[model samples]
Target: MLKLDHITVVPPTLAEGVRHVQDCLDIEVPFGTRHEYMGTHNHRLQLGDGIYLEIVAFDPDGISPRHARWFGLDDQKTVRSNWDAGRRLRGWVASTNDLRSVLAKHGEIFGTEVPLPPENPVFAFAIPKDGSLPLDGAAPSLIDRRGVPVSSEKIPDRGAVFRSMTLEHPEPEAIERLYEELEIDHPPRVVTGTEVRYRAEIETPSGLKELT
Candidate 1:
């Protein structure tokens, strides 16, 4: 079965992102390591369940990626605009064990099968050359851990549990086709909308909270 691995919160910077999450969930999130290849760093909070919440942003000192960065971070205009307004949720990723077959069935959804950076432990699919996903980024990126267990237990707990995830897109059926092809067992709910949007509902230490 496919699993919801982690949801990404793309802030202008890692500190701002951590603040955003802490403010909403009323829990302190610890920092994670940098993705040298993607030029991004993060603060992560384990959801108690297998899933985790990641607040990722570009690392100023990190080298520029030779290719497009992940989680739509390469788009400085959008990132800055959103950051200026307020830090918020960006997108989510799903994990599948059989990535090769899953990609073969739904490769077009991810664009192309770009190789993961050596530093990235879990296998992940990349945004295509233009750095766009099927519904212009509403769709969750696919990943395969190859039996590597996620260390969610080691992560400091703030009492967050994932409840549901929803992905809205202009063409709901197109996104549906991608899900059907990949056969991800617990994929997020699909909805029709004018533009791509992602939302995740979690039971936090304080109360039910949303990230979008």
Candidate 2:
């Protein structure tokens, strides 16, 4: 079954991304390893359940494949806010033990799986190459780096946790059917929206805060 894996945050640069997140949430994000193949590095934040947050950015010094070069970094601008004023949360990933079979089954509905480095073996279902997720007011395609998914052991979790996640779509029936076909857990609620919004309840030092 496909499960809600984690959310990815793309920033112009690795350092700026980490700093921006720290300033926004008033929390420290731990550093993670770099993806030599994609020219990307990341910082991680643990959430409730097995979910986590990944702040990823392109590293010019690293070797990135030609196909993965059309993300946000190409524009040379940094993300000032975590949610891009609510425009973020462009897409998400679903975990599976057999990604190849899943991709083959859903290939017609969801575009082909983006290839990842051998070291990072996870696959993703994303929009077609011509259709991309919008970022910085532009629609850019989404890519998945499978093998490098955030491991459960790495997230610190602190005191906060993710209770649940909901994906809103105008075609709720179609989305529901897709989830059912993929054997993913249907969210308790579905709302209407052109883009996806991720809401979570997290435990903070002051108290509990609902993160949207």
Candidate 3:
């Protein structure tokens, strides 16, 4: 029911996030849109095949929402803790057509769906009540685009093509089982590790590069 949409890089700040991507892929990501409702912003780059990469961070100038911010940005302590641990290539978002159905079946794992930009909402994103990552980044975050695809042209392309992503988790078997149940297409490869983290292989202008 779900497919890979984009990979995310979480950092302490927007500039740091962009720099992390640049250091990894050796290309500067272009500025993307800001989520006024969610009170965050991002820098994005196209990665071919309808997939992209984003460096998302909290927008200090943005008005804080009543609810928890997405991607666990509201939890600055944990965000910095993960960043300091070198888990920069943190998570990925998956697109689903039947978000309500998925949430009905796995609401605890994916969280409740909320329409963004409340007044004139365009899409529904599943966010945990505490705004934590799905399985703490062991699994993909869910996004229902309302049947509209994110335009690759709008996101700059620096000759980057997503090769694959791998996830390291303490309980790889559990995560693997969850992916099987989700029926996800192009899901990240999951393996055993001390903690949850992700590594993506991308074909960039400088040749194949790994973004952690």
For candidate 3, which ten residues in a row score worst on lDDT?
133-142
lDDT of 3 by residue, 54-124 (tens): 99998989989978898999999999999989999889999999999999999998899899879998999
Candidate 3 local lDDT, residue 194: 95
Q: Which residue ranges in model 1 land beyond 4 Å of their true spot?
A: 82-87, 119-124
The clash tally of candidate 1 reads 0
- Top candidate on TM-score is 3
lDDT of 2 by residue, 5-48 (tens): 66656666677666655654566778877877656677777776
Off by over 4 Å in 2: 69-85, 113-116, 119-150, 186-188
Instruction: Estimate, for each residue in 178-205, the C-alpha lDDT of model 1 and write its tens digit.
Output: 7765666677788997666777788986
Error of 3 at 48 (Å): 0.3
Clashing pairs in 3: 89-212
TM-score of each: 0.85, 0.70, 0.98
lDDT of 2 at 173: 72
Candidate maximizing lDDT: 3
Give lDDT: candidate 1, residue 203: 94
